[model samples]
Target: MITIEGVDAGYGRLQILFSVSMKARSGEITAILGPNGSGKSTLLKTIFGQTSVYNGSIKLDGVELSGRPPHEIARLGIAYLPQINNLFTDLTVRENLLMSGYMLSEEERRKRTEEVFQLFPFLRNMLHRKAASLSGGERQMLSIGMALMRRPKVIMLDEPTANLSPKMVNTVLDVVRRLRDDHGFTVLLAEQSVVKALRLSDHAVLLVGGRVLFEGDPSELLNNKELGRMYLGLGGG
Candidate 1:
């Protein structure tokens, strides 16, 4: 559903992604796995129009997204969730969700909220609570739920498991998998958690120094300890 070719992006004169090319199929989870500062996040930001792309093309369902603004790209069915500072901590959970549906009608907003509530049932009880008081897991759930308000065809998540408990991480991964399997949402997840990301993904891309080192089925990385260690920065099986 999405295709990127020779994409390069960075701040000012410092380029972070180097001729990075990749693709995400519809209704499948495609993971971008790499160590810190490998430009995985920049690739996502470029696709979402958060970062400037000096060169190459990012096509979503055959339309070029390179020069489009973020909102315009969003209207084209792309949703991005960055790693940190994802939610409004002072607002109530319901209010935060309402913000995502600003473009929808009142009835549509309520219906979408109900749909999101089904994904994170924990929010159903805490609708009135301020986001600041919610646990890390709950905050992540809120962030994801907000993104889903528009029912995007493509979703990009950056380091979703960062700073979360193991149990919460599992819960979040389960939701990601369910989105692909049950809802036909295309997923592009950039994560530092190699093992878990690979386990949940239908395909994986390994990046090092802003370059794609490997792109293939997840089992290829999982079954080969040496390749995982060398390319993914893992030391052992």
Candidate 2:
């Protein structure tokens, strides 16, 4: 449902992504795996309009999105949950959820908040608590829950499992899988943890030096020792 073609994006006068192209299909969990500085996050930002796309095009459901603002992208059913600084730490859990739906009407906001709470019941009990007081895992859950408050068609998560405990990581991945299987939401996840990401994804894209090194089912990556060792530093054997 999302297509990025030959996208080049970077900070002012400094390019990070170079002609990267990929597609995330509806009803699939596509994982973007790469080592640090591989321009994986840049690809997401360029698609979401957070970075300027100097060349090529990003299309959501067949409409071009190159010059649109980030909020416009959001309104088109794309939600981006970045690796860090996604929420207002000082805001209460309920307040944060409320903020995510500010673009919707009051009745729509309440409806969406209930839907998010259904996905993450733990947040329901902590509605009055400050976001900063929650544990790291809880914070991450909150971030994802807030993104769900928008009722997006495509949810793009950048390193959702990053800094959580092992159990928490499993919890987050379980939620993501359920989001795809049960809720039918299209998921595009960018992660550095190849093994965990592959375990949860339906498809994989390997990126290096701001380009698509490989793109296919996870088995292609998990079965290739040479590719894994060369790009990801994992012995794959």
Candidate 3:
């Protein structure tokens, strides 16, 4: 499991996350829900070592991760996909996947690429196409495929469904579910779609002003009339 306890982190001296504590359990989806500036992305970045951590601890299965660099954190089987700039826009889909696993042997890289293709069959057909040419949903698919190439135990996705059609949103969220349910991968999703994300999530963390306002069962958050309507944009039922 990925555990965070009293983690204060941000870019340089600017502190965004204030004593953030949470757990992303294995084989389950943990939805990081919040308003636009609620620090959802910061929490994910803090865990991935992108931001400076001032206090507390971040541990993956009991190993300290706060002081480690991003590459070192990634080598620990954690793949973090930020909201933007996740893909090499100039590179072909196949090339991006190859780049993700360059440290592996040639044969192993090919094998892993095939595994990613099996999970996302459409990627094989679009291997020659540049990532810049693909749609939002397609880019997300390619991004996830590239992450899978490295075989990560934990996947942190920052709005995987951003800027996509409604249908594409569902499609991407389904794949996120599969990563947890079928592949037994731990997923920490920071999403903009509140209802869809909560419905699919096993656990929910509601962040407001860089603090944990709520954290627990998804159902509880869904049923919260005040919070749902006030901040989450969920209509009264």
Candidate 4:
């Protein structure tokens, strides 16, 4: 499980999270829902060691993640997939997966690559295609396929469905579901699509202005007429 207790973090001197505390239980989908500047992205970044955490702890399965470098954190089984620039656009899809698994032996890379292909079979045929040449949905598939190479215990996805067509949104989200359901991977999803997110999440954390407004069952936030209408823009809440 990923645990955060009294975390205060941000870039340099500017703090975005304020005494943020929450627990993302293992093998479940934890939705981080909020408005644009409410620090959803910052919260994920804080856990991944991208932000400066002035106070509190970020622990994954009892290991302290604070003060660790990004690569070290990654090595420890926390894989972060940000909203943008998630892949090497200059490289081919095959090359991108290769780069993601550089730490593994060539034989292991081949094995994982096949596993990725099993999840995104379309990628198997597009191995030589440059990441920049794929469609938005296809690129996202490749990007996520790369993350899967590590076989991480936890995957922190920052708006995995962003900038995709409506159909593609569901497509990407289905993969998010499989991450928890099929692979038993813990998922931390930060999303702006409130209702859709709530529907998929097993647990939910509502953030407003960098603080936890609500943290409990997904249904609690979805059923709350006031908070739904006021903060989440859920119509007729």
lDDT of 2 by residue, 1-237 (tens): 988888888877788888888888998999998889998888888878888678998898899998999989988999999989999999999999888888889998888888888889888899999999999889988999999888889999999888888898898899999999989999999987678888888888898888898888888888888888898777745
Tell me each candidate's RMSD, in Å, in order. Answer: 1.2, 1.2, 0.8, 0.8
Candidate 1: regions farther than 4 A off: 231-235
Query: Considering only N, C-alpha and C atoms within 3 Å, which residue pairs clash in candidate 3?
Result: none
- lDDT of all predictions: 0.89, 0.88, 0.93, 0.92
What does candidate 1 score on TM?
0.96
lDDT of 3 at 181: 82
Q: Which stretches of candidate 3 lie over 4 Å from their true place?
A: none
Q: For each predicted model, how many residue pairs clash, with residues at least 3 apart or on different chains?
A: 0, 0, 0, 0
* TM-score for each model: 0.96, 0.96, 0.98, 0.98
| lDDT, candidate 3, 1-237, per-residue tens | 999999888889999999899998988899999889999999998898888999999999999999999999999989999999999999998889989989999999999999888889999899899999999999998999989888999999999998899999999999999898889999999998889999999999999889998899999999999988877888888
Scored against the true structure, residue 165 in model 4 reaches a CA lDDT of: 93
TM-score of 2: 0.96
Candidate 4 lDDT tens digits, 9-84: 9999998999999999999999999878999999999999999999999999999999999999999998999989
Q: Write the per-residue lDDT of candidate 1 for residues 1-237, one digit (tens) a residue.
A: 888899888877788999998888888999998878888888888898988788999999899999999999999999999888888898999999999888899999999999998888889999999999998888888999999999999999998888888898998888889889888899999987788898899988888899888888998977778778876766684
Q: Pick the winner on TM-score between candidates 2 and 3.
A: 3
**Candidate 2 Cα outliers beyond 4 Å, as residue runs:** none
